[model samples]
Target chain A: MAVRNRLTGERTHVPSAVGRRSRVASGPHDRHHEIIDAALELFATIGYSGTTMAQIGDRLGMRGPSLYKHIASKQELLVEIVTGMMDELLRRQRAALAEGGDVRQRLSSIVAVHVQYHAEHRYEAFVGHREIDSLEEPHRSHILDLRREYESRFRELVQEGRGLDLFRTSSDRWSSYAILDMGIGVSAWYNPSGSVTPDELAATYAELALRMLGAERGD
Target chain B: MAVRNRLTGERTHVPSAVGRRSRVASGPHDRHHEIIDAALELFATIGYSGTTMAQIGDRLGMRGPSLYKHIASKQELLVEIVTGMMDELLRRQRAALAEGGDVRQRLSSIVAVHVQYHAEHRYEAFVGHREIDSLEEPHRSHILDLRREYESRFRELVQEGRGLDLFRTSSDRWSSYAILDMGIGVSAWYNPSGSVTPDELAATYAELALRMLGAERGD
Candidate 1:
């Protein structure tokens, strides 16, 4: 059977009907996205070790071999999902940094992006938090690199705020960790059907984060 | 070969000396603690659904049937572990509250207790965060009740601080969640061999929590 590797844009496995559907359902930019979506649901439910290719295949209505058409291995699939989430997070942070607004606005935008992204893509966030370690050595290190880059964005913002005398925190990294912790925790319990919308939740968290940063009320 | 029921305070399953030593080397209290420890480790690694009696038994160097002699079922074991952790948390909170300090001091003590407990009992903390949903109806509700009660301690502290005009946050419950999230995240990535000791880490977090609560710097 001829294998077409959708991930690397190379030929590795035969394009079965399931693989064909995955390719067709997701446009060129979305192929990786669909695999991540399926992975998130499976990882959240059965956890990283317990979830197998066959189970993810079942979820996507693909045969076990057909899954290989999209990705090389289970570990690759996990790496793709976690990397994708972290990449998007980094993208938002970069945008916030480049926007060059006041510290308050920039910080608010950061919190908003975090809360909105996690709320909209809860499965990815959940899996990223819980299952990233399951990836093999190179893949795991790559994910960690992305995570550290993402975290550095917040740390930089906090340090900048402190430098400008806008805040007075003892340690900028721990403060940033605390804020990110709150944002990540939203995935565990926040529900769209609940009273608060994602935007509102983000705004609320922004206010709380700003306060935590020692921003005055008018700031 | 009678099996001794070490858990129920009855000798229902009195095993032979060899079997007893191989099955449960620890005394009743020690054996129960060992089971909880084993369950916590398994649950943290594989999650609740992914872990089975056989896997936990393997951790204890026993077969599935041998585990049954100590605990009625996997669910029972999970309940005991979760409840034990929660009970310890509540005791810590009560002790902190009973220290009879002002709001900031009391809040700092609470944060220290929370971070220290979660850092020391990392596996149990992971299970408490991730696997509470897999519990059955009554057990699930009972665990949730314990969680809600535990959460209320933080909320009450925040509310008292608010009454004293210490906190500037809008929602007490949300602030409580924020503080708890920081402490919970400690279990996810804390390394004792790293730069910070658990006590120092807890102190750092306690300072951040106090700042988030808008407590006076000196207080």
Candidate 2:
């Protein structure tokens, strides 16, 4: 059974005709994205270690062997989820920061972007936060490196604010972590159907972040 | 192999003689506490679902069956770790709030106690946060009930502050969760051996919490 990539021409296992319906409909790339979406849901529900490749296939109505055609391995699925989410976070964070204003405005923008990401990417955020320890080898270190890079952005922001006397606290790593960590908490329990919209939550968080950083209100 | 609980006088699983030694050391109650402690370490390292009763027993220098004399099943161990930590958190939070003066002081006190609890019971906190989905039936709901109650304290504090015009934001449950969630973040990444002590972290978090609440600096 030759499960081949239509585009890459890479062969591993044989996907059924139903699984390989790329000549029409959504195309191969869309199917690949769907496979990842299915895997993300499973990872959030059952965790990375507990989820099997077959389960991911089952979720997509495909055979377990056929999933190999789209993705290399379950580990790859996790790497994709963790790294992909980190990349998105970094992108959003950079864009938010690039909007560029005073320290208070910049910090508020950062908070808004963060909470928005957590709300929109709840499953990805969950897998990213909870499954770091499940990763082995290069993946673990790579993800940690990305995380450190992201964390440093927050710390640097706080430091810049401190230098400008626009923010308060000890202006240390601990203070930065406190603010950033609170943003991360949104992924754990933010209910989309709840009373608050993502914008509302983000607004409130921006206010909280400002207060936390000791930004002078009404400035 | 007759393993009788000398305290409860109940026979379940028979542990080896090496496992039955209380002659020269801590009693059965202490052994029970130790089992939970060892399990907490394993949970933090490998997660709850990945950890086995035998692994927990081995960590405590006892056989799996013998460990049962002190503790019960893995589910029970998880239950003990999560509930015990919640019980402790509730106690400490209540104590801290009891010593409060005004809304600012109360909120600050809450944040300090929360950060302190996260730092002190990191393993327990980690397991509690990450392993909630794995708990079955009554246990999951029970733990969640306790969590909701704990969360409501913060919400109530925020509400009280808002009533007095001391706090900003919408004064909703979401706002309270933002503050509480950041405190929960401490358990995920707070390093005890780092330059920041628990007191220092708590102090910073308390100040941040106040700022988040829109408290005036001089107040």
Candidate 3:
């Protein structure tokens, strides 16, 4: 079977029989995932710069040295958290766009997706925003490309909406930035313990996003 | 003579002779400012965690150890950069509000001051946002309090506007957060070599802030 990712155009081919085993989850792999989750919490709270391998391992009840056997380094975890979210965001955004609605419907879906992703992965989003400069080499450029691509999706939506005369703005690029920045800010302040649920916040932001583009209220 | 800081509400007594002569500045003080300017650039580029005192010193003309004579520690520089900005922003925001206009006019002025401050002090603003968690206890709480006060100014404006029927939003607090976040983001991406000036960008944001509140266009 051959499959192509709709957004990134990444393709993978898997023999039907070989692909049937569900990628063979193992103890090591499961532990790796746990380590990444722990790492995300530490990195988000203390910052990637301020966090250390020992602290990440301690959070998982493992020794610092043993963590090296499971994960390469703190940088590896940083790469995983940052890249995973961008890729997932691109996936969800593409899926939303594929639903195929009018500009307003699509815009609402996009806003919802943006807010939901941020709320769901607050730590990853926080680290991804604040720690970009900490990333070295090709990884840095790769993530930056993904971010640009993610943001460009909204810009394209604005451009198409403007073309249809459904949206109004003096500058498409700046307006698009303004819209994205507002939703993006949710990740920074969103808290599970807070009164507002992700769904409620997303809904509120969707309405506000429409208003930002000059859409009438209750329309 | 006596003096009071309008932004911070600090009171001090000043002997006219004691305060006289020195707005011209001194070598040590000037060097300290230069070091801060240098720190801002390095911290923004390298990520505060990755940047070292040696690197900061390298950015200036001094050797790493020699740099200690000018600035106490990297943490000292961080504190100076972050708090100086919070103090300055509060001052500017208070100044704008002091102008005293209609609700819409006051909101516009607040937005303008926010964007303009962020743009002019891009590196400081970037560090302030990204490095908060890197700070230790008392400093961290102090800065957070200052940020709270800064944001409360916008919240008060939103509340007053909502009271006047000039601003419309379900949650004044969240909407105020959204408005401030949008302008705070300008610091991250605003480029001097870019097409627009800070004043122009602030005007655009001021209008956008009004739109996000569901205000009538050109009203």
Q: Each model's DockQ? A: 0.33, 0.57, 0.48
Per-residue lDDT of candidate 3, residues A1-219 (tens digit): 555445565654442242233447655447789899998998888888788888987886666887887788888999999999888999999999999988888888988899888887888888888777778888999999999999998889888888878887777788888878877788898988989988888888887788788753335
Q: Interface root mean square deviation of every model, in Å?
A: 2.6, 1.3, 1.1
Q: DockQ of candidate 2?
A: 0.57
- Candidate with best DockQ: 2
DockQ of 1: 0.33
Ten residues in a row with the worst lDDT in model 2 chain A? A14-23
TM-score of chain A of 2: 0.85
Among the numbered candidates, top lDDT falls to 3
lDDT, model 3, position B27: 53
What is the C-alpha RMSD, rounded to one decimal, of candidate 2?
Answer: 7.6
User: Better model by TM-score, 1 or 2?
Assistant: 2
lDDT of candidates 1 onward, in order: 0.79, 0.82, 0.83
Give stretches of model 3 more than 4 Å off.
Answer: A1-29, A216-219, B1-29, B216-219
Error of 2 at B112 (Å): 1.6
